[model samples]
Target: MIAEVMGAICVLIGIPFFLTGTLGLLRLPDIYTRLHALTKADNVGLGFIILGLAIQSGSWLEVARLFLIWFLVLLASATSCHLIAQAAFEKNIKPWTKEE
Candidate 1:
């Protein structure tokens, strides 16, 4: 019972990070800011979700798989973000700046 409750709590905690990232993606002015918001929030959110699932898993093997999935996601997100940012830079896309 306690483990279930804790897992639920962890999942709940992760939800807001995902929402915040979505908000940032919609509201932020530039690609860099959006990527920053998305990658950071998603990484933390995914970590929390994986932790929750791992805790609720029936066996150590399941927990390990959860962690592996999380790691792969992290790796993929980082690589993709870097590639996108580099493409933007190569294309001469400037970050948004506040008007003076």
Candidate 2:
């Protein structure tokens, strides 16, 4: 019961952040900031969903695949985001400024 509830909770929490990441891609200014949101929150949301699914499945193969997918997501997202950020930095793109 508790596991099921936790899985459900994880799904609920993850989906919103996933959506927010997508929305943030549209809402944020600058490619670097957008990349940060797209990579970080999106990867975290994916990890959460994968973790929830693994917990619910409770099968050896399923757990293995879930972990693999999560790691792949982390690796891919991090690499891509790093590339984007580096390119932006090299191009002399400005970071966001506060209103003070």
Candidate 3:
């Protein structure tokens, strides 16, 4: 019972992170800021969701798979974000500023 409640709570909490991340992607200026919002928030959101699912999981294999998926996504997102930002930097893209 406790695990179920906790899992539900975690899932509920995770939803807002995804929403805010999407909002940031739409509202923020510059690629860097958008990437920050996406990577950070989505990572946390997925973490919470995975945690919830793991808690609800009945088998060790399922939990391991969930964790593996999260880890893969984390690595992929971080690498992709870095590559994109670096490319933008090489192209001499300027960050959006308040004055602009």
Candidate 4:
């Protein structure tokens, strides 16, 4: 019962992060900021989700698999974010800055 409650709370907590990430993706002004918001928020949200699922998992193997999937996603997102930023930089796409 406690595990279920905790898992539910964790999932609830993660939902906002996902929503905020999507909002940021759509609302942020620049590519860099959008990527930053999306990647960081989504990663944290995914972590919370994975943690909740792991907590509710019936076996260690399932928990380990969840963690492994999370790890892979982290690696992939980071790598892709970096590559995209680098490409943008190469193209002389500047980050958004406040006009003084």
Q: Where is model 3 poorest over a 10-residue stretch in terms of lDDT?
A: 91-100
Tens digits of per-residue lDDT for model 4, 34-65: 99988999999999999998888889999999
lDDT of 3: 0.94
Off by over 4 Å in 3: none
Compare the candidates by lDDT and give the number of the best one: 3
lDDT per model, in order? 0.93, 0.85, 0.94, 0.93
Collision pairs in model 4: none
Compute the lDDT for candidate 2.
0.85
Q: Mind giving the per-residue lDDT tens digits that candidate 3 earns over 24-83?
A: 999998899999999999999999999999998889999999999999999999999999
RMSDs, each prediction?
0.7, 1.8, 1.3, 0.7
**Number of clashing pairs per prediction, in order:** 0, 0, 0, 0
Judged by whole-model lDDT over C-alpha atoms, candidate 4 comes out at 0.93
CA lDDT of 76 in candidate 4? 99
Task: Name the lDDT value of residue 17 in candidate 1.
Answer: 94
Each model's TM-score, in the order given? 0.97, 0.85, 0.94, 0.97
